[model samples]
Target: MRPLEVWLYGAGLVLSFVAIVSLTRSIVVTIAKRKIVEERKAVQQEVQKKNEELVKQSALVESEYFVEREAREKLGLGREGESVVLLSPSATEPGIAAPVPEAVQETKSNFRLWWELFF
Candidate 1:
C-alpha cells in the first residue's frame, strides 16, 4: 500500500475514536444532570409539604379553644364561680371508679392526646 493511503487510514481511525469518546462523555454527563434535577425536585416537594403543615399548626395555635384550654390546664385558672378540683390518683381506678375530674372530662383532640401519651 502507498504511504499516503496508510497515513490517511490511521488518521481516520484516530478521529473516529475521538468522536466516539466525546459522544459517550456527553451521554454520561446528561444522565448525571438528570439525576441531580430529580433529587432537587424531591427536596422541593418535601419542603412544600412541611410548609403546609406549619401553616395548619399556626392556625390551630391562634384559635380561641386552644388558648382557653391552655389557660385552664396550664395556668389552673377559671371564670367566676368556676372552681377547679383536684383528685387523688387512686380515685381514677377503672374497676371501682370515682367521679372523673372536670379537667379530664374536657376532651382533647385525638392526635394531641396520642402525642401526649407516646411522647
Candidate 2:
C-alpha cells in the first residue's frame, strides 16, 4: 500500500511540472509576437510619412510656379525688357562698400555661360 501511494505522488508531481513548463513557453511566444506586431506598426507609420512627403514633392514639381522658378534661377532668365539686377554678396551687408557693377548680356543663354565656365 505504501509503495502504491508513493508512485501516485510522483506521477502527480511530474504532471504539474509539465503543465507549468508548457504554460511558460506559451507566455514567451505571446510576448515575442506582441513585440513583432509593435515593430511592424512603427515601420508602417514611417513608410506612410515618407509617402506623404513624396506626394507633396511631386505636386510641387508639377506646378507652373516651380517651372518658372527653376528657369529663372538656373537659366538667369527674366520677363522681356525687364532688367535683372544682380547684387554682390558683400553689398547686402550694412557696412559701406562700393559694389562694382558687372553687366551680363540679356541674350546670353545658359549654354553660353556653361561653355565660358568650362572652356
Candidate 3:
C-alpha cells in the first residue's frame, strides 16, 4: 500500500476507536442517570403514600364520633339527653385524704396562738 493511504487508514481507525469509547461512556452515564431518576420517582411515590396514610389516620382521629367517644369515656361527659352518673371511689384508694382528728386541730390552734404570743 502507499504511505499516505496507510496513514489515512490508521487515522480513520484511531478516530473510530475514540468515537466508540466516547459513545460507550455516554451510554453508561445515561443509563446510570435513568436508574437514579427511577429510584427518585419510587421514593417520591412511597413518601406520597405514607403521607396519604397519615392524612387518613388524622381524619379518623379528628372525626366527631371519635372525639365524642373519647370525651365520654375519659372525662365522664354525656351527650344531650344522656344521663351520666358518677360513682365515688373507695376511701382506701391512694388519692383519698384521711380525716384529721378534732384533737389534732385543737392542738394546732393552741400552738399557733402560742407562736403569735411569743412573736
Candidate 4:
C-alpha cells in the first residue's frame, strides 16, 4: 500500500477508538446517576411514611389528653371533700398539723386578668 493511504487508515482507527472510549464512559456515568436517583426516591418514600405515622400518633395522644381533661373538669371525680384521719406511729411522737386547703381565688383573679388583656 502507499504511505499516504496507510497514514489515513491509522488516523481513522485512532479516531474510532477514542469515540468508543468516550461513549463507554458516558454510558457508565448515566447508569450510576440512575442508581443514585432511585436510591434517593426510596429514602424519600420512607421518610414520608414515617412522617404520616408520627402525625397519627400525635393526633391519638392529643385526643387522649383532651378526654382526660374533659373527665377531670366536667365530672369532678377527684377526692374533693373527703377527710383523712391520721394515726400516730407512737404515742410519744409529735402530732402533725392538719393540711389546709388553698383558696380558689387565685384562679378567678387570673381568669379576670386574661379576659381584660384580650378584650
What are the models' TM-scores? Answer: 0.63, 0.60, 0.60, 0.52
lDDT of 4 by residue, 1-119 (tens): 99999999999999999999999999999999999999999999999999999999888768967666665667644445754444545644668565566876455687798999999
lDDT, candidate 2, residue 111?
A: 96
Q: What does each candidate score in C-alpha RMSD?
A: 14.4, 8.9, 6.0, 11.3
Better of 1 and 4 by lDDT: 1
Which TM-score value belongs to model 4?
A: 0.52
Candidate 4 regions off by >4 Å? 64-119
lDDT (C-alpha) at residue 78 in model 2: 83
Best-matching candidate per TM-score: 1
Q: Candidate 3 has which clashing residue pairs, if any?
A: none
Q: Report the lDDT tens digits of candidate 2 across residue range 1-119.
A: 69989999999999999999999999999999999999999999999999999999999999999988887888878878988777667777887697556786478899998999999
- Per residue, candidate 3 scores C-alpha lDDT tens digits across 64-116 of 99999899889999989999986546546797776655854444687798999
- In model 1, the worst 10-residue window by lDDT is 98-107
Task: Give the clashing pairs for model 2.
Answer: none
- Once fitted onto the true fold, the runs of candidate 3 whose alpha carbons sit more than 4 angstroms away are 80-119
